[model samples]
Target: MNADFPFRIVGFDLDGTLLDTSGDLAAAVNHALTSVGRPALSVEEVRPMIGGGARHMLAQGMAATGGCTEGELDVLQRRLLDYYAANIADKTQPFPGCLAALDNLTGRGVRLAVVTNKLEHLAREVLDALHLTSRFDAIIGGDTMGPGRGKPAPDPVLAMVQRCGGGSAAFVGDSVYDVQSAQAAGLPVVACSFGFLQQPVETLGAEAVIDHYDELIPTLVRLGSAA
Candidate 1:
């Protein structure tokens, strides 16, 4: 690790933090809803429902569009995932300056990992489509750590450290689950103000907040120095 850089491994949340997947995600959700003759939601309306896994987002979508039974949710979730997998990168792209930020960290020899609540195959497929899968040292998904151990449980965050061969670590994300998971794993976390936030960014309780990826390296440096 570079002596000037305080962290050895940095973990990131994929969907909202690294990529702006709201457009494609919203489309997938609408696909499922429309298949059952339900109303479709706007990207804005579906943005906040992201961060959780697909099932959770679809559940929220169903609730918003007039509710559904458990079995209905089960069926819709499959439809949603199928549609999403096929259209994963249709409108998905890195957040502004995100690639630059990743390059900066990698230049400093900081191993990078992606820990997301999205399903593993789906996450990998999308990253593959964008040709970004090679950039990460580890790509852990909601299913990687098994059931009930995705986020807010410290498992995947801990797995990232282990997969990166262990060192001083930090995390970046846009949700309470991300903050809680990193904190539980005893790592400082930065929150993204431009991501799909379900609540006020300030309320997520991250160590630092960056409004744009342009601010990321400096914020991480500051946090590292403080540590």
Candidate 2:
């Protein structure tokens, strides 16, 4: 392994790992819930529902508000998406030091990509709205690879490596999906403790855990050393 940086490519989970999008997401979910006469959820309550994507988030929200039929869920899901798209970045911003950490990795010749469970266009819209589109080599979304092939399946991570020119890679994310996918892809992972985690960070099973972006590169360096 090269001592400078063992990985040539680094993949990230978008919603929690890169951006603090819980506020906007909670608003969208509340929009849908209100449309169906259900009560709203707090940002803290909605944060854990986010990792699996909009539909999953809505499902969780509806479950909290007396559940819904497939038909009801479908209508609410579309409403949630439309509301979210229109205000994708109202309160969304990069987690502290994420941009600098990206820059640090880029300076080291490490390519970066986002492997999100968000739908492709929504992810693009959110990134574009935040003016962060140019920072990544690729932004693979939940639907990008068809049904059931998002994170935790290893497919998206494998695709990210290929799209970034097929070298050693690592994944940075906050959820079990992220860690599982990286491990499945034979890569090390770093979990972000500050992210909107559904479970406790200790259960993520990543090679390392970081509380801030300032710790990201150093954690990666240590992972590289161990590799």
Candidate 3:
């Protein structure tokens, strides 16, 4: 309802931003660890290890389990992915007020997109399982562009803008990667306070932070107007 809102495209990170996927992601991490004779990790224990991607999350779990060989990690990574794709939505759901917030944005003619470090098929699979795939105007994953150019780099963020038909954009996410990427892309970012903050949320260096999705639109209005 704030007509002065300046952004046209609003991009979001998938895992910790829009959806609370910590439960299922932790299960996949624990499954991979236990198969290699390592102990299982609790969901709360694995919360901070997420966000980068499956391999990064598994690496953290493996490191906690005393580490494993590169070849062993390769096999375990595949195993983790399989299990995660199989049970993608078992414990995953949109964060409280997320759908309503998205509805508000859509009604305001803002284009919505998802740009995640999650692999393409897997991100789409999880979105499909939740029947939420139709919500976004675009979905770009880690592998969608190329290797090593996912986040903390401007490639995918630029791609999000291009794919959304080129307009002033802002990104919403829950991690340093998200902040780093958006800043690199020359866009303002809003961090989610309730997300899987690996460190203190203040450390992310975002323009604004919201404790809940209900605050998102007003936060965006301020961020956009200030820009």
TM-score: which candidate is best?
1
Each model's TM-score, in the order given?
0.99, 0.98, 0.98
lDDT of 2 by residue, 1-227 (tens): 33488889999999999999999999999999998789889999999998998888999999988988989888889999999999999999999999999988888888899999999999999999989999999999999999999988999999999998998899999999999988999999999999999999999888999999999988988898898
The candidate that wins on lDDT is 1
- lDDT of each structure? 0.95, 0.92, 0.93
Q: Model 3 — which ten-residue stretch has the worst lDDT?
A: 1-10
lDDT agreement of model 2 with the native = 0.92
Per-residue error for 188 in candidate 2, Å, reads 0.8
Count clashing pairs, candidate 2: 0
Off by over 4 Å in 2: 1-3
| Global Cα RMSD, each model | 0.6, 1.2, 1.2
Please provide, for model 3 over 106-222, each residue's C-alpha lDDT reduced to its tens digit, 9 standing for 90 to 100.
Answer: 999899999999998988998999888999989999999999999978999999999999989999999999999999999999999999889888889999999999999999999
> After aligning candidate 3 to the native by TM-score, how far in Å is the CA of 217 from where it should be?
0.3
Worst 10 residues of 1 by lDDT: 1-10
Using lDDT as the yardstick, the better of models 1 and 2 is 1
lDDT of 3 at 213: 98
